[model samples]
Target: MDFIFFDADGRYFNFLCLYQILYKPVILTIFSAMQTMRWAFMLCTISQLDVLIYNFENMKELVKAGNCEINEAFKDGFKKNIVHHCAIIQFVNTIGRAFGGQILLFFMINSFIICTTAVQFFSIPNPLNNIMELVWIFGFLFIMIIMLYIDCYFGTIITEKGSQISMTVYCFPWIDLKQDLKKQFIIFFVRNQQDLVINASKLIPVSMTTFRKVMNWTYKGFAVLNQMRK
Candidate 1:
């Protein structure tokens, strides 16, 4: 019994040492590549956020006293728009969250298979090695996958919101049926008309400027996430 335990412990230590020898270079390369991707995603995302904030602040600077009344009018108009669309937003957001979860699960399972297969390739040098290699690969992949999704979402939202907000700024009194945004909103989202009415009631008290900001955000959020999924 003592002899068997001694052999097993020695083998475990040997495997540990082998892991240290083989692990760093390959794992570091993968990590470095992933880090580069994450950094690029972050830079793009941050640039978009910075642009949005810059434009929003610039718009704030341009506000005059007479615009305050227009702001109230906008508030009323935006309130109605939101109430008409709030339910639809809730439904869309719910679907988005559900689908996002599903996609994440798929990535996790897919990554697991890839890592498991990779472990087989790694074991060619010492075919009899135990399960520790797989554990490390999976641990590393899981962390990277999380990073991937976060960066992806950030990049998507910033770009989407930035462009959409800019467009909204250019077209404030955009109540025309001929306009693209209102047309789509009416067609795709106005199916839940009661939801829009309820949403507008909640939005009306906050002022049109506030509601417009939120609507812009919601619009951009959908656009960003949709791009990310693509």
Candidate 2:
């Protein structure tokens, strides 16, 4: 009976080891790939916005150089550019709708992870004895912080670039153009007066401000946990 029990236990241990060695890595790899794709999508959106801004800048240069003739063709091209701007805004809104929930969850989870990791790192009694463990913990903490920063950084860029459009439109020589074109310029300028902002689940604005708040909350939670431990 004792020999049979030992064999069964050994098999169970091997099964768990195999699951950990094989299954966990595969699952983690899939998750990492998904995250990479999501960020890539965000970057693609930003690049599109950059292209729109570049076009606006080119238009401004043409107007400044007195090369833009106020004719039917110019009017048609101007209207098309406004339409393109609206299309880009729609694309941004679509991205927010698709990824807002995921972004919210990411912020929540990373905040908890950061707080707990900090507490654990500080709680360790013998820093020199468990060097590898310490390194692992620090690496994870760094990655979490970096991920948060990247998200917020991109969000900031989007807001800044979007705001730049209004200024670019303002710089156009609208006063010297035809009355109809002046009206169109006014409408476009008024439309762009509001800065573009991406919100998480339509609740949290995903900018540097949010990033700072998350870090502050994490620090507060870490302090509280340390106090409880003491």
Candidate 3:
């Protein structure tokens, strides 16, 4: 235990030897798991959206040839598709809900970490003494920002593709459909109009907008801290 808990000469080395080895690795693992889960959800959502879009394209192809008669089988298949899509959407939402609180906490803690690291890096006068500390802070800052960017980018993709599904439905020849089928299509379109947007704790929608906001906020906060330090 003494050997594992021993401190090094440099601050960064000490941190790496103690917290990094004992605690940071665990924290990183958890974050990695969350990130992987998020990526998986986004991919699944996109792939399912692709499937729906393909179905819509096929329907469009059928209707393009003046064949407006939608068979009973097609109607049934459409209904099943609706259910499948809703399930996928709901699953993502559930994932968001389950992890949203943790995500918020993660962002808050990371922000603090970045702030303190920046302060230490910029405030310290002796560069030789704290070179490792500078490198450590910079590395973490870069990695965290990159991770956030990927998260928001993928989230944006999910929403955009989900919204396009409704548009795909609209592209179909609805006017020529039988009255009952037309009614069903109308209902489906209306349902899809809601679109799929997974929010973090219902506060921040996980999209590029959030990414920009976070970056701006971090920068402003860092600037303020820097001024306070001076």
Candidate 4:
């Protein structure tokens, strides 16, 4: 521990002590706010994915009644669901665009933090002396990874569920419907052949593939730091 200054009386003040006394609470409060925001983002993303999955199931159920008897109500309901699905996709994309920069910045900073923390952990001379500090850094790094994974996981689910809509349409009892209705259904199915993807500002997609890339970047950074330390 280094002293910041010493008085004529030989009394010393430490920067770390000042940090604990005057800055720790502020830092903790900022971290708390960030964690809250992340939780809200995750909740909203997952809810949208759940809505998508529910709509897919509804479509599948609609087609299960294979009596060529899709009532007006059922048709209306299906149309409404299609609109609802579109709305969800739009909502997610809007959010992705809005937070893309923030998320990208967070991941970049997190990668650097991981690299530095790993280097410190490996270079520490006395494990017992800094064990608590290492644990704190590791805990934060783990939380960040988990949060990133969750965001990617929900986005992947949304993509998969959206794509599954076409499969559900294919499994429908199109042979039992009137020719006109069958043609309309075919058009709808064709429109849905392409999957809905939510991208980060239309750049990187939010998926496991991106998550894996981020982790790889972190590892590469850590290795580079280790080499530099030598």
Cα lDDT, all candidates: 0.44, 0.81, 0.76, 0.69
lDDT of 1 by residue, 63-117 (tens): 4434544344443454444443343345434433433454344334544444444
Off by over 4 Å in 3: 1-27, 65-76, 124-135
Off-target runs (Cα >4 Å) in candidate 4 are 1-42, 48-68, 71-74
**Lowest lDDT 10-residue stretch of candidate 1:** 196-205
In candidate 2, which residue pairs get closer than 3 Å at backbone N, Cα or C atoms, i.e. clash? none
Q: Order of all candidates by lDDT, from best down to worst?
A: 2, 3, 4, 1
Model 1 accuracy (lDDT, Cα) = 0.44
Clashes per model (N, Cα, C within 3 A): 9, 0, 0, 0
lDDT of 4 by residue, 89-205 (tens): 677777677777766776677667777877877887787888888788678778877877876786687677677666765665556667776777777777777766667667778
Q: Which model, 1 or 3, shows the larger TM-score? A: 3
Which candidate, 1 or 3, has the higher lDDT? 3
| TM-score of candidate 3 against the unseen true structure | 0.79
The pairs that clash in candidate 3 are: none
- Residue 46, candidate 3: Cα error in Å is 1.9
Query: What C-alpha lDDT, on a 0 to 100 scale, does residue 12 get in candidate 3?
Result: 61
Residue 54 alpha-carbon offset, candidate 2, angstroms: 1.3
Q: List, residue by residue over 86-205, the lDDT tens digit for candidate 2.
A: 987887787689888988999999999999999999988899999998999999999999999988888888888888878876776667778878888888888888778778999998
